[model samples]
Target: MSRGFLPRQHGAWAMLLIPFLFGMFAAKPVWQHALLFLGWLLAYLFVYAFLQWVRTGQIRLYGRPLLLYGALLMPTGAALLWLEPGLWPLVPLFIPLFLVNCYYARRNRERSLLNDLAAVVQFSLIVFAAYELGGGSDWRLAAALFAFSVLYFTGSVFYVKTMIREKHNVKYYWVSVGYHLALLALAAICYPPGLLLPLAVLLVRAIWSPRAKLTVKQSGMLEIAYSLLITCSVLLVYAV
Candidate 1:
Protein backbone atom coordinates (compact mmCIF):
# COMPACT_ATOMS: atom_id res chain seq x y z
CA MET A 1 0.00 0.00 0.00
CA SER A 2 1.14 3.54 -0.66
CA ARG A 3 2.01 5.68 2.30
CA GLY A 4 -0.67 8.03 1.13
CA PHE A 5 -3.23 5.31 1.68
CA LEU A 6 -2.57 5.36 5.41
CA PRO A 7 -2.77 8.21 7.85
CA ARG A 8 0.65 9.19 9.14
CA GLN A 9 -0.63 10.65 12.39
CA HIS A 10 0.11 7.88 14.86
CA GLY A 11 -1.79 9.40 17.77
CA ALA A 12 -4.80 9.81 15.54
CA TRP A 13 -5.11 6.05 15.22
CA ALA A 14 -5.63 5.86 18.96
CA MET A 15 -8.07 8.74 18.88
CA LEU A 16 -9.94 7.02 16.08
CA LEU A 17 -10.13 3.51 17.51
CA ILE A 18 -10.28 3.81 21.29
CA PRO A 19 -13.51 5.76 21.59
CA PHE A 20 -15.21 3.58 18.99
CA LEU A 21 -14.12 0.52 20.93
CA PHE A 22 -15.30 2.07 24.17
CA GLY A 23 -18.71 2.71 22.66
CA MET A 24 -18.97 -0.74 21.18
CA PHE A 25 -18.11 -2.30 24.50
CA ALA A 26 -20.49 -0.02 26.33
CA ALA A 27 -23.43 -1.41 24.42
CA LYS A 28 -24.38 -4.73 22.92
CA PRO A 29 -22.07 -5.47 20.01
CA VAL A 30 -23.65 -6.63 16.76
CA TRP A 31 -22.05 -7.87 13.57
CA GLN A 32 -22.80 -4.51 12.04
CA HIS A 33 -20.23 -3.01 14.37
CA ALA A 34 -17.51 -4.55 12.18
CA LEU A 35 -19.00 -2.95 9.12
CA LEU A 36 -19.23 0.36 10.92
CA PHE A 37 -15.56 0.24 11.88
CA LEU A 38 -14.49 -0.50 8.33
CA GLY A 39 -16.48 2.42 7.02
CA TRP A 40 -15.10 4.63 9.77
CA LEU A 41 -11.53 3.60 8.95
CA LEU A 42 -12.04 4.30 5.27
CA ALA A 43 -13.56 7.67 5.99
CA TYR A 44 -10.47 8.68 7.96
CA LEU A 45 -8.21 7.63 5.12
CA PHE A 46 -10.25 9.47 2.58
CA VAL A 47 -10.25 12.62 4.65
CA TYR A 48 -6.55 12.44 5.36
CA ALA A 49 -5.70 12.10 1.72
CA PHE A 50 -8.01 14.93 0.81
CA LEU A 51 -6.45 17.14 3.46
CA GLN A 52 -2.95 16.37 2.20
CA TRP A 53 -3.99 17.38 -1.26
CA VAL A 54 -5.46 20.57 0.10
CA ARG A 55 -2.39 21.36 2.19
CA THR A 56 0.23 20.88 -0.47
CA GLY A 57 -1.71 21.39 -3.69
CA GLN A 58 -0.02 18.20 -4.81
CA ILE A 59 -3.00 16.64 -6.44
CA ARG A 60 -0.91 14.19 -8.38
CA LEU A 61 0.50 12.70 -5.18
CA TYR A 62 -2.67 12.64 -3.15
CA GLY A 63 -5.36 12.44 -5.80
CA ARG A 64 -5.14 8.72 -6.33
CA PRO A 65 -5.43 7.85 -2.67
CA LEU A 66 -8.24 10.31 -2.28
CA LEU A 67 -10.19 8.80 -5.12
CA LEU A 68 -9.48 5.23 -4.11
CA TYR A 69 -10.39 5.76 -0.48
CA GLY A 70 -13.47 7.69 -1.44
CA ALA A 71 -14.49 5.01 -3.87
CA LEU A 72 -14.14 2.39 -1.15
CA LEU A 73 -15.73 4.55 1.51
CA MET A 74 -18.91 5.52 -0.31
CA PRO A 75 -20.23 2.01 -0.76
CA THR A 76 -19.05 0.87 2.67
CA GLY A 77 -20.61 3.88 4.36
CA ALA A 78 -23.81 3.54 2.33
CA ALA A 79 -24.02 -0.12 3.26
CA LEU A 80 -23.62 0.64 6.94
CA LEU A 81 -26.25 3.36 6.75
CA TRP A 82 -28.54 1.12 4.76
CA LEU A 83 -28.37 -1.44 7.52
CA GLU A 84 -28.96 1.17 10.23
CA PRO A 85 -30.70 4.16 8.78
CA GLY A 86 -30.62 5.89 12.16
CA LEU A 87 -27.00 6.93 11.45
CA TRP A 88 -28.14 9.23 8.68
CA PRO A 89 -28.84 12.10 11.03
CA LEU A 90 -25.34 12.06 12.51
CA VAL A 91 -23.75 12.91 9.17
CA PRO A 92 -24.56 16.58 9.31
CA LEU A 93 -22.86 17.05 12.66
CA PHE A 94 -19.49 16.29 11.08
CA ILE A 95 -19.60 18.70 8.14
CA PRO A 96 -18.71 21.85 10.02
CA LEU A 97 -15.93 20.15 11.87
CA PHE A 98 -14.59 18.81 8.62
CA LEU A 99 -14.70 22.30 7.18
CA VAL A 100 -12.70 23.56 10.13
CA ASN A 101 -10.06 20.97 9.39
CA CYS A 102 -10.08 21.86 5.72
CA TYR A 103 -9.61 25.53 6.50
CA TYR A 104 -6.62 24.77 8.69
CA ALA A 105 -5.13 22.41 6.19
CA ARG A 106 -5.43 24.93 3.40
CA ARG A 107 -3.58 27.43 5.53
CA ASN A 108 -0.98 24.81 6.50
CA ARG A 109 -1.98 25.30 10.11
CA GLU A 110 -3.02 21.76 10.64
CA ARG A 111 -1.14 21.75 13.93
CA SER A 112 -3.03 24.70 15.31
CA LEU A 113 -4.82 23.99 18.56
CA LEU A 114 -8.22 24.90 17.16
CA ASN A 115 -7.80 22.51 14.25
CA ASP A 116 -6.65 19.79 16.59
CA LEU A 117 -9.69 20.35 18.79
CA ALA A 118 -11.93 20.19 15.76
CA ALA A 119 -10.48 16.81 14.91
CA VAL A 120 -10.91 15.76 18.52
CA VAL A 121 -14.56 16.68 18.41
CA GLN A 122 -15.01 14.64 15.24
CA PHE A 123 -13.40 11.58 16.82
CA SER A 124 -15.36 12.06 20.04
CA LEU A 125 -18.59 12.18 18.09
CA ILE A 126 -17.74 8.72 16.85
CA VAL A 127 -18.28 7.42 20.36
CA PHE A 128 -21.90 8.37 20.17
CA ALA A 129 -22.25 7.02 16.67
CA ALA A 130 -20.75 3.70 17.67
CA TYR A 131 -22.85 3.57 20.79
CA GLU A 132 -26.00 4.04 18.77
CA LEU A 133 -24.84 1.43 16.27
CA GLY A 134 -24.50 -1.10 19.05
CA GLY A 135 -28.05 -0.40 20.26
CA GLY A 136 -26.98 1.49 23.35
CA SER A 137 -30.05 2.96 25.03
CA ASP A 138 -28.63 4.94 27.92
CA TRP A 139 -28.30 8.45 26.62
CA ARG A 140 -26.51 9.50 29.78
CA LEU A 141 -23.78 6.89 29.35
CA ALA A 142 -23.34 7.72 25.66
CA ALA A 143 -23.06 11.40 26.39
CA ALA A 144 -20.66 10.75 29.22
CA LEU A 145 -18.48 8.62 27.01
CA PHE A 146 -18.48 11.33 24.36
CA ALA A 147 -17.45 13.94 26.91
CA PHE A 148 -14.73 11.71 28.29
CA SER A 149 -13.30 11.11 24.83
CA VAL A 150 -13.26 14.80 24.08
CA LEU A 151 -11.69 15.73 27.40
CA TYR A 152 -8.92 13.15 27.29
CA PHE A 153 -8.03 13.74 23.65
CA THR A 154 -8.11 17.50 24.05
CA GLY A 155 -5.70 17.17 26.97
CA SER A 156 -3.58 14.98 24.76
CA VAL A 157 -3.35 17.78 22.20
CA PHE A 158 -1.94 20.09 24.87
CA TYR A 159 0.40 17.52 26.38
CA VAL A 160 1.81 16.50 23.03
CA LYS A 161 2.51 20.12 22.13
CA THR A 162 4.42 20.53 25.36
CA MET A 163 6.40 17.41 24.63
CA ILE A 164 7.34 18.17 21.03
CA ARG A 165 6.27 21.43 19.41
CA GLU A 166 6.58 23.60 22.50
CA LYS A 167 9.15 21.72 24.50
CA HIS A 168 11.24 24.76 25.30
CA ASN A 169 8.25 27.02 25.95
CA VAL A 170 7.58 27.20 29.67
CA LYS A 171 4.17 28.82 29.28
CA TYR A 172 2.84 25.99 27.12
CA TYR A 173 4.18 23.43 29.58
CA TRP A 174 2.23 25.02 32.41
CA VAL A 175 -0.80 25.26 30.16
CA SER A 176 -0.64 21.54 29.59
CA VAL A 177 -0.26 20.86 33.30
CA GLY A 178 -3.10 23.19 34.20
CA TYR A 179 -5.36 21.62 31.62
CA HIS A 180 -4.68 18.14 32.96
CA LEU A 181 -5.31 19.35 36.51
CA ALA A 182 -8.57 20.90 35.40
CA LEU A 183 -9.54 17.62 33.76
CA LEU A 184 -8.84 15.75 36.99
CA ALA A 185 -10.93 18.23 38.94
CA LEU A 186 -13.77 18.02 36.45
CA ALA A 187 -13.69 14.24 36.48
CA ALA A 188 -13.78 14.19 40.25
CA ILE A 189 -16.81 16.41 40.35
CA CYS A 190 -18.77 14.98 37.44
CA TYR A 191 -17.60 11.41 37.04
CA PRO A 192 -17.55 8.22 39.06
CA PRO A 193 -14.79 7.44 41.53
CA GLY A 194 -13.55 4.65 39.28
CA LEU A 195 -12.98 7.15 36.50
CA LEU A 196 -10.71 9.26 38.69
CA LEU A 197 -7.86 6.76 38.52
CA PRO A 198 -7.30 7.22 34.79
CA LEU A 199 -7.64 11.00 34.94
CA ALA A 200 -5.20 11.10 37.83
CA VAL A 201 -2.77 8.99 35.88
CA LEU A 202 -3.18 11.32 32.93
CA LEU A 203 -2.44 14.28 35.18
CA VAL A 204 0.66 12.56 36.48
CA ARG A 205 1.88 11.86 32.98
CA ALA A 206 1.31 15.42 31.86
CA ILE A 207 3.41 16.60 34.78
CA TRP A 208 6.18 14.02 34.57
CA SER A 209 6.49 12.75 31.01
CA PRO A 210 8.05 15.84 29.48
CA ARG A 211 10.59 16.10 32.29
CA ALA A 212 11.46 12.44 31.91
CA LYS A 213 13.38 13.31 28.70
CA LEU A 214 11.54 10.72 26.73
CA THR A 215 11.91 10.37 22.97
CA VAL A 216 8.96 11.02 20.64
CA LYS A 217 8.43 7.32 20.12
CA GLN A 218 8.54 6.72 23.87
CA SER A 219 6.01 9.44 24.47
CA GLY A 220 3.78 7.98 21.78
CA MET A 221 4.03 4.51 23.30
CA LEU A 222 3.08 5.91 26.70
CA GLU A 223 0.09 7.61 25.12
CA ILE A 224 -1.07 4.30 23.69
CA ALA A 225 -0.87 2.85 27.17
CA TYR A 226 -2.79 5.77 28.63
CA SER A 227 -5.45 5.48 25.95
CA LEU A 228 -5.96 1.82 26.84
CA LEU A 229 -6.10 2.68 30.52
CA ILE A 230 -8.79 5.28 29.93
CA THR A 231 -10.78 2.91 27.72
CA CYS A 232 -10.67 0.16 30.32
CA SER A 233 -11.48 2.59 33.11
CA VAL A 234 -14.55 3.81 31.26
CA LEU A 235 -15.68 0.27 30.62
CA LEU A 236 -15.30 -0.67 34.27
CA VAL A 237 -16.95 2.47 35.52
CA TYR A 238 -19.92 2.72 33.19
CA ALA A 239 -20.13 -0.24 30.87
CA VAL A 240 -20.01 -2.86 33.58
Candidate 2:
Protein backbone atom coordinates (compact mmCIF):
# COMPACT_ATOMS: atom_id res chain seq x y z
CA MET A 1 0.00 0.00 0.00
CA SER A 2 2.87 2.27 0.76
CA ARG A 3 4.83 3.84 -2.11
CA GLY A 4 7.95 2.15 -0.80
CA PHE A 5 6.42 -1.22 -1.65
CA LEU A 6 6.69 -0.11 -5.24
CA PRO A 7 9.35 1.75 -7.18
CA ARG A 8 9.03 5.29 -5.80
CA GLN A 9 11.68 6.96 -7.90
CA HIS A 10 10.35 7.41 -11.41
CA GLY A 11 13.79 8.56 -12.47
CA ALA A 12 15.35 5.33 -11.30
CA TRP A 13 12.72 3.33 -13.12
CA ALA A 14 13.54 5.27 -16.27
CA MET A 15 17.22 4.53 -15.79
CA LEU A 16 16.44 0.85 -15.37
CA LEU A 17 14.12 0.61 -18.34
CA ILE A 18 16.12 2.60 -20.90
CA PRO A 19 19.36 0.64 -20.72
CA PHE A 20 17.60 -2.68 -20.57
CA LEU A 21 15.52 -1.74 -23.59
CA PHE A 22 18.54 -0.35 -25.37
CA GLY A 23 20.45 -3.57 -24.85
CA MET A 24 17.52 -5.70 -25.92
CA PHE A 25 16.95 -3.61 -29.01
CA ALA A 26 20.66 -3.60 -29.78
CA ALA A 27 20.82 -7.40 -29.66
CA LYS A 28 18.59 -10.38 -30.30
CA PRO A 29 16.58 -11.44 -27.30
CA VAL A 30 16.37 -15.08 -26.35
CA TRP A 31 13.86 -16.86 -24.13
CA GLN A 32 16.21 -16.77 -21.19
CA HIS A 33 16.34 -12.99 -21.32
CA ALA A 34 12.75 -12.90 -20.21
CA LEU A 35 13.75 -14.65 -17.04
CA LEU A 36 16.66 -12.29 -16.74
CA PHE A 37 14.38 -9.26 -17.02
CA LEU A 38 11.97 -10.67 -14.49
CA GLY A 39 14.74 -11.48 -12.11
CA TRP A 40 16.25 -8.03 -12.51
CA LEU A 41 12.89 -6.38 -11.87
CA LEU A 42 12.28 -8.40 -8.74
CA ALA A 43 15.81 -7.77 -7.57
CA TYR A 44 15.28 -4.02 -7.81
CA LEU A 45 11.95 -4.27 -6.03
CA PHE A 46 13.59 -6.13 -3.21
CA VAL A 47 16.41 -3.64 -3.01
CA TYR A 48 13.97 -0.75 -2.86
CA ALA A 49 11.92 -2.37 -0.11
CA PHE A 50 15.02 -3.31 1.81
CA LEU A 51 16.44 0.18 1.54
CA GLN A 52 13.19 1.70 2.73
CA TRP A 53 13.16 -0.63 5.69
CA VAL A 54 16.68 0.38 6.59
CA ARG A 55 16.04 4.09 6.17
CA THR A 56 12.82 4.28 8.14
CA GLY A 57 13.49 1.61 10.74
CA GLN A 58 9.97 0.39 10.21
CA ILE A 59 9.54 -3.32 9.72
CA ARG A 60 5.80 -3.33 9.43
CA LEU A 61 5.69 -1.62 6.07
CA TYR A 62 8.89 -2.54 4.23
CA GLY A 63 10.49 -5.08 6.51
CA ARG A 64 10.40 -8.85 6.76
CA PRO A 65 7.39 -9.57 4.60
CA LEU A 66 8.61 -7.56 1.66
CA LEU A 67 12.13 -8.82 2.18
CA LEU A 68 10.95 -12.37 2.27
CA TYR A 69 8.84 -11.89 -0.83
CA GLY A 70 11.76 -10.32 -2.66
CA ALA A 71 14.13 -13.06 -1.59
CA LEU A 72 11.69 -15.66 -2.81
CA LEU A 73 11.48 -13.94 -6.18
CA MET A 74 15.25 -14.12 -6.61
CA PRO A 75 15.29 -17.85 -7.17
CA THR A 76 13.51 -17.22 -10.46
CA GLY A 77 16.44 -14.97 -11.32
CA ALA A 78 18.86 -17.65 -10.23
CA ALA A 79 17.02 -20.00 -12.55
CA LEU A 80 18.33 -17.86 -15.40
CA LEU A 81 21.72 -19.33 -14.58
CA TRP A 82 20.33 -22.66 -15.69
CA LEU A 83 19.29 -21.14 -19.02
CA GLU A 84 22.71 -19.62 -19.54
CA PRO A 85 25.20 -20.88 -17.06
CA GLY A 86 27.49 -18.08 -18.17
CA LEU A 87 25.36 -15.71 -16.10
CA TRP A 88 26.76 -17.36 -12.98
CA PRO A 89 29.96 -15.36 -13.00
CA LEU A 90 28.15 -12.05 -13.10
CA VAL A 91 26.03 -12.76 -10.02
CA PRO A 92 28.54 -11.60 -7.47
CA LEU A 93 29.09 -8.30 -9.25
CA PHE A 94 26.02 -6.76 -7.64
CA ILE A 95 26.81 -7.76 -4.08
CA PRO A 96 29.22 -4.96 -3.40
CA LEU A 97 26.72 -2.45 -4.74
CA PHE A 98 24.05 -3.86 -2.49
CA LEU A 99 26.34 -3.40 0.46
CA VAL A 100 27.02 0.16 -0.58
CA ASN A 101 23.30 0.84 -0.91
CA CYS A 102 22.75 -0.54 2.54
CA TYR A 103 25.46 1.67 3.94
CA TYR A 104 23.96 4.78 2.36
CA ALA A 105 20.47 3.87 3.49
CA ARG A 106 21.72 3.47 7.03
CA ARG A 107 23.39 6.86 6.96
CA ASN A 108 20.46 8.57 5.21
CA ARG A 109 22.88 9.72 2.51
CA GLU A 110 21.31 7.77 -0.32
CA ARG A 111 20.86 10.96 -2.31
CA SER A 112 24.42 12.20 -1.92
CA LEU A 113 26.29 12.78 -5.17
CA LEU A 114 28.67 9.91 -4.43
CA ASN A 115 25.79 7.55 -3.81
CA ASP A 116 24.09 8.70 -7.00
CA LEU A 117 27.24 8.03 -9.00
CA ALA A 118 27.57 4.60 -7.44
CA ALA A 119 23.97 3.87 -8.37
CA VAL A 120 24.64 5.03 -11.92
CA VAL A 121 27.40 2.47 -12.12
CA GLN A 122 25.29 -0.21 -10.52
CA PHE A 123 22.23 0.30 -12.70
CA SER A 124 24.33 0.60 -15.81
CA LEU A 125 25.28 -3.04 -15.30
CA ILE A 126 21.84 -3.84 -16.68
CA VAL A 127 23.06 -2.81 -20.12
CA PHE A 128 25.79 -5.39 -19.93
CA ALA A 129 23.48 -8.02 -18.50
CA ALA A 130 20.87 -7.36 -21.12
CA TYR A 131 23.53 -7.51 -23.80
CA GLU A 132 24.67 -10.89 -22.58
CA LEU A 133 21.14 -12.16 -22.17
CA GLY A 134 20.11 -10.96 -25.63
CA GLY A 135 23.07 -12.84 -27.13
CA GLY A 136 25.25 -9.83 -27.74
CA SER A 137 28.95 -10.62 -27.70
CA ASP A 138 30.32 -7.19 -28.36
CA TRP A 139 31.84 -5.83 -25.19
CA ARG A 140 32.42 -2.49 -26.87
CA LEU A 141 28.74 -1.84 -27.46
CA ALA A 142 27.88 -2.77 -23.90
CA ALA A 143 30.58 -0.45 -22.67
CA ALA A 144 29.12 2.36 -24.72
CA LEU A 145 25.73 1.90 -23.12
CA PHE A 146 27.37 1.97 -19.71
CA ALA A 147 29.15 5.21 -20.53
CA PHE A 148 26.01 6.95 -21.77
CA SER A 149 24.09 5.82 -18.71
CA VAL A 150 26.76 7.22 -16.45
CA LEU A 151 26.75 10.53 -18.24
CA TYR A 152 22.97 10.87 -18.23
CA PHE A 153 22.48 9.84 -14.61
CA THR A 154 25.35 11.90 -13.35
CA GLY A 155 23.66 14.87 -14.94
CA SER A 156 20.48 13.79 -13.20
CA VAL A 157 22.22 13.85 -9.84
CA PHE A 158 23.42 17.39 -10.39
CA TYR A 159 20.00 18.45 -11.63
CA VAL A 160 18.23 17.15 -8.54
CA LYS A 161 20.81 18.54 -6.15
CA THR A 162 20.70 21.92 -7.81
CA MET A 163 16.93 22.17 -8.09
CA ILE A 164 15.78 20.70 -4.80
CA ARG A 165 18.47 20.11 -2.22
CA GLU A 166 20.80 23.03 -2.94
CA LYS A 167 18.83 25.45 -5.07
CA HIS A 168 20.39 28.54 -3.52
CA ASN A 169 23.86 26.97 -3.49
CA VAL A 170 25.26 28.94 -6.44
CA LYS A 171 28.50 26.98 -6.58
CA TYR A 172 26.85 23.59 -7.13
CA TYR A 173 24.37 25.17 -9.52
CA TRP A 174 27.13 26.38 -11.83
CA VAL A 175 28.95 23.09 -11.46
CA SER A 176 25.85 21.33 -12.74
CA VAL A 177 25.65 23.68 -15.70
CA GLY A 178 29.32 23.28 -16.47
CA TYR A 179 29.13 19.49 -16.31
CA HIS A 180 26.16 19.41 -18.66
CA LEU A 181 27.96 21.68 -21.16
CA ALA A 182 31.13 19.58 -21.01
CA LEU A 183 29.15 16.43 -21.52
CA LEU A 184 27.38 17.98 -24.49
CA ALA A 185 30.73 18.89 -26.03
CA LEU A 186 32.10 15.43 -25.43
CA ALA A 187 29.07 13.77 -26.93
CA ALA A 188 29.26 16.04 -29.94
CA ILE A 189 32.87 15.11 -30.50
CA CYS A 190 32.61 11.40 -29.82
CA TYR A 191 29.16 10.24 -30.90
CA PRO A 192 27.61 13.30 -32.41
CA PRO A 193 24.65 11.84 -34.28
CA GLY A 194 23.25 9.37 -31.76
CA LEU A 195 23.67 11.50 -28.66
CA LEU A 196 22.60 14.81 -30.19
CA LEU A 197 19.01 15.05 -29.01
CA PRO A 198 19.50 13.59 -25.53
CA LEU A 199 22.50 15.76 -24.69
CA ALA A 200 20.79 18.89 -26.02
CA VAL A 201 17.74 18.20 -23.89
CA LEU A 202 19.95 17.63 -20.87
CA LEU A 203 21.78 20.91 -21.47
CA VAL A 204 18.48 22.73 -21.58
CA ARG A 205 17.34 21.18 -18.29
CA ALA A 206 20.68 21.85 -16.67
CA ILE A 207 20.37 25.51 -17.62
CA TRP A 208 16.69 26.26 -17.17
CA SER A 209 14.89 23.76 -14.96
CA PRO A 210 16.70 24.52 -11.74
CA ARG A 211 15.84 28.18 -11.95
CA ALA A 212 12.11 27.54 -12.43
CA LYS A 213 9.95 27.69 -9.33
CA LEU A 214 8.19 24.41 -10.05
CA THR A 215 6.55 22.42 -7.29
CA VAL A 216 7.60 18.86 -6.60
CA LYS A 217 4.82 17.28 -8.66
CA GLN A 218 5.42 19.63 -11.59
CA SER A 219 9.12 18.92 -11.53
CA GLY A 220 8.41 15.20 -11.47
CA MET A 221 6.19 15.53 -14.52
CA LEU A 222 8.91 17.43 -16.31
CA GLU A 223 11.45 14.78 -15.41
CA ILE A 224 9.21 12.08 -16.82
CA ALA A 225 8.96 13.96 -20.08
CA TYR A 226 12.71 14.41 -20.22
CA SER A 227 13.27 10.77 -19.42
CA LEU A 228 10.94 9.73 -22.23
CA LEU A 229 12.67 12.05 -24.67
CA ILE A 230 16.08 10.67 -23.78
CA THR A 231 14.86 7.10 -23.93
CA CYS A 232 13.14 7.62 -27.25
CA SER A 233 16.11 9.44 -28.71
CA VAL A 234 18.44 6.61 -27.83
CA LEU A 235 16.03 4.06 -29.23
CA LEU A 236 15.57 6.04 -32.41
CA VAL A 237 19.30 6.44 -32.98
CA TYR A 238 19.81 2.72 -32.72
CA ALA A 239 16.71 1.85 -34.71
CA VAL A 240 17.94 3.90 -37.63
TM-score of each: 0.97, 0.91
lDDT of each: 0.91, 0.81
In candidate 2, position 95 carries an lDDT of: 84
* Predicted candidate 2 versus true structure: per-residue lDDT over 1-240, tens digit per residue: 555577667778877777788787777777777787788777788888888888889888777658665776868866777777867777787788778888999999888777788788788888878888878888887787778878888888899888888999999999999999999898888663867877888898888888888888999998898888877887777634
Which lDDT tens digits does candidate 1 get at residues 1-240? 576777778999998898898889899788999999999999999999999999999988888998898899999998989999989999999999999999999999999999999999999898888899989899898898899899999999999999999998899999999999999999889999998888999999989998999988888788888988988888887777
Provide the lowest-lDDT 10-residue window in model 2: 1-10
Stretches of model 2 off by over 4 angstroms after superposition: none
Work out how many backbone clashes candidate 1 has.
Answer: 0
What value does the lDDT take at residue 33 in candidate 1? 91
Each prediction's RMSD to truth: 1.0, 1.9
Cα deviation in Å at residue 61, candidate 2?
2.6
